[model samples]
Target: MTIYILLLLIAMQLIGVYFFQNLEDRFYENFRDNLEKQAGILQEVIKDKMTPGTESEKQRKAIDDILNKLPLDKKNTIQIVDQESVVIATTSGENSRIGQKNKSPRVSRVLQGIESPSVEVSHKAGNRYMVYSYPIKNDGDIIGAVYIEAPMQEMYDTIRTVSKILIKITAAAMVGTSLLGIILARTITNPVKEITEQATVMAEGDFNRKVTVKSDDEIGKLASAFNHLAQHLRDALSQNEEEKGRLQSVLANMSDGVIATDRKGKVIVSNRRARKMLGKDIELNEDINQVLPLANPISFPLTEERESFLELNRDEDETLILKLTFTPVLRASREAVGLILVLQDVTEEEKLDRQRKEFVANVSHELRTPLTTIKSYLEALDEGGAMEEPELASRFLRVTRQEAERMTRLIHDLLQLSKLDSEKVRFHKQPLRLEELLEDAADRFSFQCRQKDIAFSLSIRKPLPRVYADRDQIDRVLDNLLSNAVKYTPEGQSVSLSAHRRSDGYVEVVVSDKGIGIPKKDLDRIFERFYRVDKARSRSMGGTGLGLAIAREIVQAHGGTIRMDSRYGEGTTVRFTLPPCEPEVNPA
Candidate 1:
């Protein structure tokens, strides 16, 4: 900007100097031309009197008269010369070079008619002069020459003064131009500087600053665009951050584990669940193939698709059944940018489904057996077996009734279990003395215990906690437990039912027996419907296999827990708790 200003100032000064110089030169030229015209008028006045027959006095008188009458100023020294090249008259008065021979070469040329009257500057008497000579003619014949000398010192002095004024103006103009140019340059440079700083800040990832718009010009528009661009970048960054947060939130909260990888199969994103479900050592920004043991997980999909499930045995106790869904996240150009792997844990669902299938088969088998038995007996009765042996026929009829009863009990228990599973069983909850309930349940099962030669006993601790529960449901739970104890116990073995106050605000009922103890491995599944340690013995003893299952559901519905503890070759204990009713507060 400074350079441009300076150049502009110099050019303006140069033009001023050139124009003023021409004006000065032209002024001097007009001054010389005026002098030549005055010289020609003086020669014309005397040329007619200077005929070859005329005397010098007559021609000189005419020249003096004409010079006096004409407007030729005294700045020029006018003199008249004859063809003899001698001065005849002068404007300098009589004492000024009268009857003197002219010594100028240009005056001699005009006398010889070798040149026209012309003007030239000469320095004489310490002053510069414009000397002009013209030929005096009469009747188309040259007679004498007239000479004029104009002093140019004063004109040059005036011209120098004018040039000085012009120079001053030009200098002022140049200085003004420089100052104005600097201001204009700042208009461009200052905004540019600001924009540069702002751009630098933007490079550092800050788009919050804006350039100051000081004008409505192109530069101002540029600043506006820059600010807009900065805002756009900020919005884009914010949007990206929001999207990243949303993606991470979704990944974290997803029930299924998720892993995303780059085009190179490098794990770019993973969640805690993914790490836990895949393996504890799974790390991000590592090769997916290396981090997780996969057979061919890196076979990236050419398009959006789903693959088969991949099952991983995470540990001895848990198997992670993951349905690995492979999908390609493509760009607008239809190029696969990366791969997404969805890991859905199906361990529990699969286990329940498998259990359901087993339960169906077990129920079918249980139902088929009794039906088969009844069918065989009825067929026998219809085949005239009653006529062959009355005792045998009576026995067959008893067997049929027993099988039918078993079938009815199985069906009833199955219906009860279905209601329990669906949570459709309504309860009539009320406070009841748990010890009294225990005594009643024990008495009901006492006869059966005696028939099996199993000793039945009840242990009730003092101040036994009263439980809030459905009476009918609880009585059934007690019946099932006592029946199992009596049927499974060896002959003369003791089965005890105990009620006590547990510290956790509940009444605990423990039905324990020195019976055929369950295997240790089967304890985990003891409450599952239709699961029995010894199925043959259980069926023979009229065990429907849904007793413990029903007991668990009823106890749990009352906000309690039922647990079974058993050891192979040792006694088994099935204990359950019922929440006690809240104590009533008397009004103060």
Candidate 2:
């Protein structure tokens, strides 16, 4: 607006200056021409009244009368000169023209008839004047010259008045033009300002702001387009937020651990499972190196044609395994921005898969041995004409029966393990005295202990707390622990069972053995199905490797915990805790 106003002001000033100069020039030209004409008429009258060659009183009166009739005032002076350049008469309140020569060279030249009648400058009475010279001729002979002087003050005064009017008009016109320019500019710029503010809001991520379009001009069209764009942006941003929320929900509830990192390998986000795996002390924005230093060297392929996995050991004690996979997240430009690290805890899955394979192989081996023995015995009986030797037949039959019993035992253990794996076993819960249960389990294992020549003892603290458990499951649990102790202990070694009250109001039953103890490294995983510290010795003793596993499950179902403390070449203690049952109250 200011620029437009400035341009209008400049243009008006230029036009005003041009008009005032032209007006001044025309005023001066017309004023000078009229003055010269009046002076010429006065000169003709004086020449007509004059007698030839002599000055007469009549001519003098005629000159004075002509001068009086002339429009000469104090601002104008008139003088008459002869052909000799001598002053003949004057209108400056003087009669000294009889001998005075015309000092103006222009007037002298005119009297000599060598110059045209013209206007020139004359100096008189201490003022400058415009003088017009004319010749009075008789019969084409130059007789006298007329000179008129008009002061330039009136022209100067007229020009000054016109100049003042022009200045005032120029200023008024400039002000009016500036105001009009500001109004017009505002009409355009005000809407643009509003659009600019709305654009700023949009840049700051507030897509809901819209610009108002009030006209069909270019600026209005721009505003309309901007509003439409903002609406679309708002919808897209809302959808993006909802998608992000769904992604977060999936990550939160996923069983597998997930960690996401930027291109710089800095941690960007982590799910609950990932945080737990990395330890709760870590937080977002922490370096991945700090959380998984060992796994940092394991890289995953994220390209379209590449897929790689890193097998990570999460627990050294239990051989817990995680499969880490990486996938790339790309922008619309197909630039890789970051990576997604997916951690699948495959410990249980992998263990179960290995167990299935081992079970098939072990079942084949166990059945093969028994079937081979029975087949050999039956073949011997069939080939030897054994009806002539009844004693040999009976022995062969007894051996066949023993082989069949072995097969039955192997099948039973396999079925029990299968039932446990499928969670098909149901337990009946009841309160049982811990000491009595321990005693019964020990008595069932006395025969094995006697064969091994291992002494067994039981220590029951007085007033031992009764435990809430499934009676049959507790019996199996106690039998498993006692039989394991007796089998592992050397001959003449003592295996002891103790029951006592724990500080946390639970009952603790500890079965300790003087045996070739387990190594510290294998203690934590002793309860895993089919895990054996000494595979050869355990199998030689008819161990199915599922006893401790079943015991663990039963204890957990009864709201109890089992743990082992062992030292190599020293001794081992297996302690289990069961919550005490509240005493039944009589009717009060």
Candidate 3:
């Protein structure tokens, strides 16, 4: 309040100064204007009388009469000089200056054809005067000039009196304003000071203290609001604690790892899952870059991206692939406060997704090859010349029929695989002679082996156990293995099928062949659908790549296990085992 009063006083003082200065300037301007008007009139009257080279007493008397008859003030003087610098006329008692070289510089300047005004002190009277001078022309020649002087003492005295009165008024206003401001400050500042003290206590975490209300005005309302704010702060802190507990519970049970960091990338919160996934317990306020595997340090003042993702593949005891999702924590104003990182293990998912893409691509390539061949052959037959030649047309028809058959086989294999994948295939399990199934597969492939001139052999160990298995499905598995053995074996190379009883009371069947073997790198994916060691050779021999995959599925369904071992450029061996049927005990 005091400061405001001081500012008001300063403003009043500035206004007083402005008005005083303006009044002084106006008085001087009016005085100069009056002198100019009088000078102009004098020039008109005397220009004809101011003749060059003329010194006449009658001319001087005529100018004096003209000056005396004018309505001039008592403190004003007017004089006229001729071209010879001799004063020709004067008003009242100034006739002593006539017929003399009136050598005033201002008057001489006017004689040279310039009109101007100036203020100077009168040495004799000790008072300031306004002096104006102008040229008088006769026949376009400056034959003489006129000079006028007016006293400024009266105008100065008036301005001085106005300034003293204005100063008195300004001083009185400042005194009155200061007294009122002090009274007002007593009412407002005391309440405000108390409220400020209460606020300071609140800042120190003491919300129990409240401001005392002494009046029912705005200050009283402010005190009431401060008390309400303290209550609200207490409630908010309690609710915040409850929410914090719930968040901790959720983080503890979450499957994915959760981590939170402040704006500087310092860890503020972490869960057990996050610690386990990172393989180290992260401490609070630790730099996030030190915890996560990063090729470059995370830059500060993080970018305003919506979110980000990172894939981390760490090869420690085993290959571990994690998908990390980063999201910024923001305030209501969309200001970033921190960061949230969620880690998910995606190793199996990535592997399965890759396999699915490969499966689709392989299917498209396989079907397109057969369909393209069929289309070409059919188009050839449709051309006029090809059908007219009987032999060529027969060959085209045969090739088309063969490709159609291949497509049919591919479709059938795909359906069989689908059923196996869904667990919809029912196995008619029974105890059967496993040796007889092996023998039948060898005999079925004997004709193909004879055509290829590959040696085929079968051996059944003595005391071979009867196994519990499916007849048709087991036959299918055996047929697939024997066909692959014979197909890959060179002419004169031997292919053998053997069945024996294992020490673990299971029947084992072994299919061995001296064939072009699988490479070591591809051995792991041998049982995957449509995975072939040699795609062109397999397609040419009418071999669907699903053979080995389907064979493995069938064997597993019959309570058995199947595996294969091969060395590049050497022989290959495929083996399987079926759980034997428990011996039937005699009924008690």
Off by over 4 Å in 3: 1-255, 269-286, 293-309, 312-320, 328-337, 583-588
Model 1 lDDT on a 0 to 1 scale: 0.82
Query: How high is the lDDT of residue 282 in model 1?
Result: 62
RMSD of each: 5.6, 7.2, 19.5
Per-residue lDDT over 384-451 for candidate 1, one digit per residue giving the tens place of the 0 to 100 score = 65748888888998998999999898899899889888988899999888877888888898888888
Whole-model Cα lDDT of every candidate shown, in order: 0.82, 0.77, 0.82
Please provide TM-scores, in order, for all candidate models, with all chains considered together: 0.74, 0.68, 0.53
lDDT of 3 by residue, 237-275 (tens): 778988999999999989999989999999999999999
Clashes of 2: 1
Instruction: List pairs with backbone clashes in candidate 3.
Output: none
Candidate 1 RMSD to the correct structure: 5.6
Candidate number that wins on TM-score, 1 or 3: 1
For residues 494-517, what per-residue lDDT tens digits would candidate 2 score against the true structure?
Answer: 888889887677788999998989
- Order of the predicted models by lDDT, top scorer first: 1, 3, 2
Best by TM-score: 1
